[model samples]
Target chain A: MSDPYVKVRDLVTHYGTRQILNGVSVDVERGEIMVIMGGSGSGKSTLLRHMLGLERPTSGSIEILGREITTMSELDLYELSKKIGVAFQGGALFSSMTVGDNVMLPLQEHTKLPIDTMRIMMRMKLEVVDLAGFEGLMPSELSGGMVKRAAFARAVAMDPPLLFCDEPSAGLDPVVSRALDELILRLRDAMDMSIVVVTHELDSAFYIADRITVLDKGDILAIGTVEEVKNDSSERIQSLLNRKLREEEPDPDAYLARLTGTKL
Target chain B: MAADHETAGPARLVESLGRGTVRAVESFGYAASIFGETVKWILLGRRRGQAVRSGPIVSEMMDVGIEAIPIVTLLTFTIGVMLSIQGLDLLRPFGAEQQVGIGVALGVTREFAPLITGILVAGRSGSALAARIGFMTISEEVAALRVMGINPVRFLVAPALLAMLIMLPSLTVWADLVALIGGGLYISADLGMTMSAYVDQVLTTLEVDDVMHGIAKSAIFAVVITVIGVVEGSTVEGGAEGVGRATTSSVVKAISAIVLTDMFFVFAATR
Candidate 1:
């Protein structure tokens, strides 16, 4: 437990000429729920993308289970991916497949279990996500929150060592949001998996996070326990916690650069 | 101002030509890259591995080929009737109406059947491939597949390619048989000729090699149609509108490729 299960050192990422992550560094201890909190355009999603090895960083490194992901080959990365599960924000379930089939996909792909066993496992996972009888329905038939829960079911289907969830609480109602947050905490404890959740929902983040990392404009503003973050003295952290609207004066020449040929 | 305008006209023309050339080259390069990847997967890929499930392949085969039959039959039968009618009328002016049976047989088996099948199938299956793949891409299903360690080629494109290769030639055969029926109807009804006489003529005029020559072109057409569809579909940029655009362009590209490839086979096989 002393050693970090996932470690990032000086990660820099860029999209075209714009730097999306500016030397961000963080560590995720084993069996801990690390909630990445940031407002829109704060680069938390970019950081999550890096952690998942979905996008390559411009500089620095990520070590997942002591293996540097940036230098891993396709075959090696695939091997690494088997131990990691990701539940995308939009669910990203195959629209053509049934909810049951979607849940059974990773198992069917990775294991040679009998069809009956696979079906049983799928139903069990669905039961875990409170989608027990909804297996026959298509993704379109499910409500938005149900779809997210279904995604969560599929992500844990393989029992991966690490799990990543992107914006799980966004666009969900407060009741559904709280339910999902509780589900996340339950799953982490039950499965003993290290989880990383990226979201901007303050309530959900506070409820489930073992620790919180707040990001602002491509930089880490604060990193500590939930209580530490709530009581942190930094003005930026305080403003984020209070949800205060930014009040910066607009610059006119910058606006002209948008109208003119950017000659300013 | 007049002198500047005079120079700018030619300069604009040159710039436009340069841009057009670059765009054409880029498109060609993109097509070639996908073609190379497809060939690699077809030759070297494992059969239904962990990441590439067999269910989708079978489903795609039905989607891409099996469902395309009725339209193929109707269109080719119409073409055969038209060809027979025109052939007999044209030959009647020369007092060579007896040769109409021979002309229809050779034309349907050797060129028209395969050509018509290519066009129809390209429109049906090629557009479907593009639309399906483009929507999957926009929905991030493709990314999910990739993140799950699945190769898109094995999971999506290869099965379609394999299905097309098997189905296109089979469809061409069906087209040929249906076309002969159409021609037979025209021979007996309009020309007051015997069906036996037309069958005998066809049997002699159309050799095994002549039929094989056309069947070979259908295989080529299948490759072209499916490749264009997958390429255009997989590379879509925007949203729902992008899927629509990709589907349309894939159909157009498939048909154009079919026409050009058919011409090459026509000249080469005869020569």
Candidate 2:
């Protein structure tokens, strides 16, 4: 309802003994595209999963459109889920369903519209992703980029007010990733929706980010506009921008314990 | 210390067995919860489209029933012939070979057809259900369905439970009929008994209760097999090989549960 269409507060998450996110927080304004950039295990994807309500945090809250998702009932959650779409890193389309069926699924499941209208709606969504005629293709038949676009089509099929894209540019070539980044921007501008993109591509992040959230090993190193982030005086942000690795060496005992699958 | 070491092997064996029993019971409860949720979705839950349709139910029937007919028929037919030969030989010792008709009829209708069909379906369609759902799980299609506001239990498990319920009893009936026919033909050929005599004796021997009892057991077996498959599948982890392991686990679990259920039904029904 407010300017911050998405607000994450003090999100802490863990898997087994590993803490993935430690008090991470972020906010994305309505109609703005925020890019969350982090190295692997920095919790960008974990944050995305929490926002999508795919998993619960250890202690924190994610509010989408002013509703806390973690506490929603099953039916309530289903209703909320229908209003927010997600494009997974791996496309995550149903392999058994056709691209057309995959996109039409949301309409079919949620609407009383007839088959003809649902088909047209599906085609329109597919067209939005530049995958108009590829509707008949199965996910298995699509190339990596096509699969990504098809997944994007399915995610936006319901025309949700909010969308989350995880690693949309991760495995794509530069040209396709650029194209995807442009498409994401276009979706935000034309569809009047807020978006949060989790990616590691520096160029794409800087190119498309209204604000970039840099996460380093479960903590936010910086959060501001691309220029503001670049101008920030933190050495960690400087090292991240310069692609510098940590200079510290691993402890021998910890290394040995890790090698032996020992828990600390 | 020496005595403790000597007894450690047996002690460890008992401890492991006890743990295994607890794990099995826990898994059964897990499967039962999934089964309960699936039934709720099938009957009263909020999910709609695809799963509640007749299309999935029929497809599952063809998978669990129609496709299984030939093998079930073959297996039951072999057992029928074997039972006839053995029954005739044993009765011949007492000049009672004519009683083979009642013996084979009662055996096929009351227990053999249902038990064997249960085992076969558990091995065949049950494992297939687990593999399909497990692959969907590992590949995140199950999660995808969830994120899209569809319950995976509704989308995947409910149709399977419904289909198994519809088809298992029907398949058991077919098994009973095929076994009866096989034994009848064997008796006509091996003992010079007329087909009419064999048919008459079978019809006289098998009451409505006998047939209904077997069908009831088949329904229960269907429930057990379906639950185990769905629960094993929805919990699959690791990856591609996990799907395979889930399939095997479902089969083993379904068969074990099927036997345990059958034993319970046997005791309860007979009393």
Candidate 3:
């Protein structure tokens, strides 16, 4: 098989003495959506950071578009970043700048297009996210959903072939969340971009992900399609999927009293 | 058991020393990174001078010059008045109240005014720089800049350093004027010296070296303050607390470096 569009091999990441990702390995083909699902502290975000080259892995390597990102020089990595777009958690919009300025930043830095042309391109991207006239608004003026949409618009500003999104459905209502999921799907289909989404929302994951990787305690518990992950016999994955609560057995006296309907 | 205890005690001390050394080295590394980034951006600005000249430079002038003028003026005025008052009182005993003008003008124009103004600016603007950069560092904005194929230092520090270097001498000159006026007023009122007499004394006593020395020291001070602020701000970790600590430490370090450098200049110029 041809090399995957993005390949993560034995990725390990640490924060001080605590290991966030033990050994995460995954691959995504071109024009595919791969969702990394995990509970909090399951290393989903860490894995995504490694893939994006924002955080280097403590051990192992991440290859994006056939280049080892960890080993690449900063200049090379910056060039590589042009081919990739990332929608960070909370949208990560520059609070000081307006939406138009933020969206135009990458183009302004990397391209020599005329200002009027850049403005037209920026408006088009805003329109893609259904935020045509909101370009003049600051990040504070945007709702949570709008902020995410604006961030999405900025991420696709350059029409990158690869997109990474962290928790697209987070902090939004169900309707809005579904709308965002639909937008993600539309972007992938329209752009034919390989997408990697990090999230804990199973329903959203199932709706958007072509394949899913389940991380438990910094290790991948299962990797497959939604149906395959659901059917996997791994107890950890099963418990997480079912939302089973593990409660200790009650004391014998309490159990007996309850059964006999005695207050003593 | 005795041998084991002795070895453990020495081992712990060695480990502590090693840890401290590592932290210091890491700090130095962060400082170097910020410096390198600043230099890279400066070069970019030089290259892009033809294309994007006015916007970045104007923004920096607002940040470094317009924002800094009031504080520098206020401090210089206060220093001038206080120095004249103190000089009048001291010279009064010698029946040389006239010398108060010479003392205040020569001292302020030559040393105290610029040094004090530099320290104050370093504390104010330098700390703010550190805090701003530290906040950016923790927020991953620096990482974001890097990912965008933009060098963080060039994008952040270069403008700040360049703006300060450009504006500081002008600021020092303003401070000298304000201080001399303050000293003149003080000498006229407190020492009973005539305004004309005080002005004549100042004109006669003030040499070219005096003005040049103040401007030269201010340039050095600008470099020290800006570097410390940028370096400390970039090195910050651990979120808000880290930013706060870095700002405080940067101000202190900048002030200390200013004082030390001022002393060195004074010694060299006098010797």
C-alpha DockQ of every model: 0.48, 0.57, 0.33
Candidate 3 chain B: worst 10 consecutive residues by lDDT? B45-54
What is the C-alpha lDDT profile of model 3 across B38-126, one tens digit per residue? 66656655564212335666787687777878887877888999998888789889998877788888889888877877887787789
Mind giving the per-residue lDDT tens digits that candidate 2 earns over B77-191? 9989988998999899899998999999998988899999999999999999999989888777887888898888887788888989989999999999999999999999998
In model 3, the Cα lDDT at residue B1 comes to: 100
Q: Estimated TM-score per prediction?
A: 0.92, 0.92, 0.87
Candidate 3 residue-wise lDDT, A143-220, digit = tens: 999999998998898899899999999989999999999999999998898899999998999999999999988999
Clashing pairs in 2: none
Stretches of model 1 off by over 4 angstroms after superposition:
A251-264, B1-20, B47-53
Q: Write the number of the candidate with greater lDDT, choosing between 1 and 2.
A: 2
What lDDT tens digits, residue by residue, belong to model 1 across residues B137-218?
Answer: 9887887776776667667887788788888899999999999989889878887878887888889888899889889999
Worst 10 residues of 1 chain A by lDDT: A73-82
Top candidate when judged by DockQ against the true structure: 2
Task: Pick out the ten consecutive residues of candidate 3 chain A with the lowest summed lDDT.
Answer: A241-250
Name the regions of candidate 3 deviating beyond 4 angstroms: A17-20, A245-264, B1-25, B44-54, B189-197, B268-270
lDDT of 2 by residue, A132-223 (tens): 89988889999999999998889998999999999999888999999999889889988998899999888999999999999989999989
Between prediction 2 and prediction 3, which has the larger lDDT?
2
Candidate 3 lDDT at A251 equals: 96
